[model samples]
Target: MFKPFINTLALSTIAIATPLIIPIIAPAHALTEAQVLERLNGIPVFTITDDKGAPLLGSAPQKGSEKPPQVLLFFLNPDDAQATLTQIQKTNPAVGSKARIVIRSMNDAYEVIKKNQDKKDIAFQIVPAKASIESARTILTSQGKPADKLPNVPVFFAIGGKDKEQGLLTLEQNGKQLVPFFFDQKDLQSLIDRAKQQQPDVANATKIQVTSLFQVLDSMVATKDNKPNPDTERFTFVPSRNAFEYVVKNQPATTPAPATKK
Candidate 1:
């Protein structure tokens, strides 16, 4: 399982006291701790535990599955969080439930994810990262996203679905590179339009605004261990770190497909 957020408590010790000291602009109206926890109700989650009955690392079940895309909002309260989630859903029904939206930094357990299932209004679920600071850093580093101040609210990721082998092949055959963007509403629409037409996974769709963000992302990741490169498709977006993993992370675990064959 891609479980890291829950157990990142160890890394939480590393904190930014004067967050705004840097020039990085953060996300708007991200969830507060309590709100982050509450949204987890009923969404599927991936947890990491030791042999003992202690919770270690875990991730909210907010994979880049469904249709339109999946968004991960930071630092928002309940009301604000709901507003952003609702607005995104108003997209074409073809993309409505296609998106999986979530918030993080809730009470480090795995209950709210189940709550989403019981109440049953949200088409997709919101997940909480028991400890998200380190996970944020990891995601930024891995995907070549910058680190000024990761957004706390109104932050979102637009994820699309895949038909498995065919999707991976498309990326490979097309020589496509997945781009990640921190977009405002207007740019977000640009991404949505391309995603709707091509239904690319988030990375692929980001190519539309490639020059804007990739330059920074490439630099950001260059300082890390696993920066994006050729293997991005094979390791990050393919069978190992690719779209298939996104689908499997939230769904019930199944035997992993063999590395090579489709």
Candidate 2:
């Protein structure tokens, strides 16, 4: 009887080992893109907190209340965060009443927000970064990016509600339609580096012509199929082209024009 029991135990061990010997297939996620989109569309809220840990948007929209278009700016580096905030202020007249500007900031963003909170030009809010990262990751994942690939620093997005008609959905500059693009500090730095190499005069100039700089980058991308490839949320967007244009037109000669690329 002991011999029989030992044999049965051995057989059971082998059965478990056999499966392990083969490659294990990872299970697919249950939610499809359509399902995810449906759920997201229905829940158009990004739950985040203020520097004080209070809800950002009053917990939730009043039942059946209409949602506005939201322009979100995420920064990796604190230094760059201020630039985004300044740009929004410069562009408020053009972006007027279209949508509210929301900047994602770490707990550290509190002081920065306090400094500029009195500014009346921009309709803006500073949201806690920790509370917003997961939502950003969810969006990134939906765009086909792995969670680990998410940026540690700063990025920006202009999110629209399911109903597109009521928000800052599209931009028109000299008749060309513009879209929002997501990019990191590295991408911006690369553009600046290349500009320095190819056009040192412009790079070294006291005041950079943002329109000309943007034109150069646009030409480079136009030749190639350079498009923002986000993995999670389908943005149908581009970087802050309008904001740059606004800054160039509104700011004084000393203000550095924003340099960004696709």
Candidate 3:
């Protein structure tokens, strides 16, 4: 029983806001372990660790279970991890001061989880950025759909096609057409705006679609062998630029060598 923890408030919000079309987004299909891990590669996730570089674990009570399960928190945004660290520092300075943020690809985390899948003591939980969640909710509401159907971090993509049928919009890069899914809504919107200016005809038909990171990963696994077009295999995930910048800025400063005595 590997349970991914979602806080009570967020869980309640998801319950009320999830649209009826969730099943369509995340179809109930069995995916092999290799498929799952292959899809997770290159996606970055953040975590907090002690000075010794071990992930900090937290326990949350599980319904119908006597003992609360231990959870390792994975953050979509470095800022969120920093916020958690700040709070820990306020309450427990000694422990917090020694804690640091670590960046790892989602595949790296999944590999570890897969190795310990049989163990019942711990589970991995994803902590989405509040801003991203709010953006997703707003988009869903505007479309007259459920506000928060995504289970994990929301991914935004643009779609446009002829008639009733629609498909992901592709952008040309280095002579290649690539479909981009963004972790940040604002980034996706920016691309949408540029596309609109460049192709007015296509812009009028463009629509923004929202899905969860987990759903996207699962979809890759499900569709791996049956891609409708070559471009479908070129799907690219665009991480939050701000989060990347934060990681670079906070990287441990390199130690300088002592100068020889004059």
How many clashes would you count in candidate 1? 34
For candidate 3, lDDT tens digit of each residue in 21-65? 101121234445464454444455677788767777777788885
Q: Identify the leading candidate in terms of lDDT.
A: 3
Worst 10 residues of 1 by lDDT: 7-16
User: How many clashing residue pairs are found in candidate 3?
Assistant: 0
lDDT (Cα, tens digit) per residue for candidate 2, span 31-71: 33233223211111111223333322222223465554222
Query: What lDDT tens digits, residue by residue, belong to model 1 across residues 81-130?
Result: 34444555574344434433332222322333323323322222223222
TM-score of 2: 0.21
lDDT for each of the candidates? 0.28, 0.28, 0.61
Off by over 4 Å in 1: 1-38, 42-45, 56-147, 152-154, 157-262
The candidate that achieves the highest TM-score relative to the unseen native structure: 3
| Regions of candidate 3 where Cα sits further than 4 Å from its true position | 1-41, 161-166, 222-231, 251-262
